[model samples]
Target: MVWAFHTDEPEFCPQCGDSLETQSTEDGPRPHCANCRTTAYHNSGVMARTAVVDTDRVLLIERGAAGDVGAWATPGGYIDAGEPPREAAVRELEEETGLEAAPEALTPVNVGFLEFDGGESDVAVNYAVLRSETAGTVEAGSDAADARWWTRDALRADLPAEKNNLRAIGMETLLDLLDDRS
Candidate 1:
């Protein structure tokens, strides 16, 4: 899990095209561009995931693209420019599962490092919602190759998998937390 995601900071100044040097600032050491007199700060991308749960079942999606292709995860995607996290959760839920949900219906349940295909630079702000809050039947769409609901036992059967799943080191703990919550 300890990967070099942020180690590839800017090697050269974006404006002056000069080699950048790590200079100490009040904030900490950052890539400093002397010619342009600016600091380059690479920030993590924001992602939103929604756990559409109803008592015993929660909707999950199979990754159709990068990261661990075919791994199951809560329906989610990157937040758009200027979009709120709650709205992004709803949008991602709809895009991946073909089910519509209101932003207000989502309740944030977790916020932590989520490894997308891009590594752990993208942080996940996750939400949980009841199935009754969603509209329409389930079907895979967008970046999801498969989408379906899973019970606790059904979810645990193939878990602790060696993939890009968060907490891949301890899926049993993840299952315990999820079970306790939903």
Candidate 2:
């Protein structure tokens, strides 16, 4: 998700210095501003992942940011407000892997959730596209440290059997995307 989960509750309202109190809303419990009467709703941030496939290999990028630094994952990121998730997926793909693609050229593979140890979470939409059409050589860009094509065998051997990699949806989605190419 694009939003970070806060482990602690807010003691003050964002709009005013008054203390924040819990109020019931249609969306459930939320923080209410005592002075401004403003209500805060918690929402999950949407994210997308692009699986660029070449033969039996899939493009993977090493994360450069903290939390998962140097760990490999599909090229993707949080969707910007007013932007479609597919477009965000393509944009992230191009930014991280230098592979240009369009929304229609990409196909949705799966949707999943990623939860962090600090209570942060994201709703991830996964996509895949054949590499024959996309242009430009693959290179690490944006916040990625590196980008490379990993064969299915290599992924299975390198990634842990447990759900611990940066792929977000785990290795099952990776295997499914690879199998779909057959």
Candidate 3:
């Protein structure tokens, strides 16, 4: 299925075993296999993140896998096919931090595109809600090494290091949005 392909997917056609060539399309260059006339379209991966807010603090997860290993970011991951973004955010939050958040309690905060070094890319949606709306103790699970609360002041004091040792996109943008909301 189309969902199985990444930005840097195989250069050979899945259907015909023929080498693929790059062809410019409206979206951009895509893999085209002339033998089978198959165009491997790479869809941007859908990801979701949630900030479990406790007054001035928010829950952060230390990634145990992928690009940001050991770096703290809000709880989140790629959304499963057919899952709604809000539900995905809540699911990821629970999966990473052991916190159960109501899907309806999550409010959309921000959305942005992320591209990785190996050509994997994602379009992430961020959500947030007060901690009172969620229930659970903080425990690292899934692909998280550590889970804990972090204050905006602490985060602002030193920008989080993500890919390229830059500020974490989720935290930076979500914090700015929180500032605007307050």
Count of steric clashes across candidates, in order:
0, 1, 0
Model 2 agreement with the true structure over 1-182: per-residue lDDT tens digits: 12222345566766667887999887778777778887665556678998888878888988888578768888999998889999999899999999999799988888888777655667899888899868899999999999998888888787554423554656877777778775
Evaluated against the true structure, the overall lDDT of model 3 is 0.76
Name the lDDT of candidate 2.
0.80
Model 3: what TM-score? 0.80
Which of candidates 1 and 2 reaches a greater lDDT? 2
Question: Per-candidate TM vs. native?
Answer: 0.76, 0.84, 0.80
- The residue-by-residue lDDT of candidate 1 on 65-159, one tens digit each, is 87578788888887877799999988888889999998998876767674534343778887778888899889999999999877778776755
- Please write out the lDDT profile of model 3 over residues 25-50, one tens digit for every residue: 99888888889788887777888888
Considering summed lDDT, which 10 consecutive residues are worst modelled in model 1?
164-173
Give the Å error, residue 22, model 3. Answer: 4.7
Model 2 regions lying over 4 Å from their true place: 1-8, 11-19, 26-28, 160-167
Which residue pairs come into collision in candidate 2? 1-122
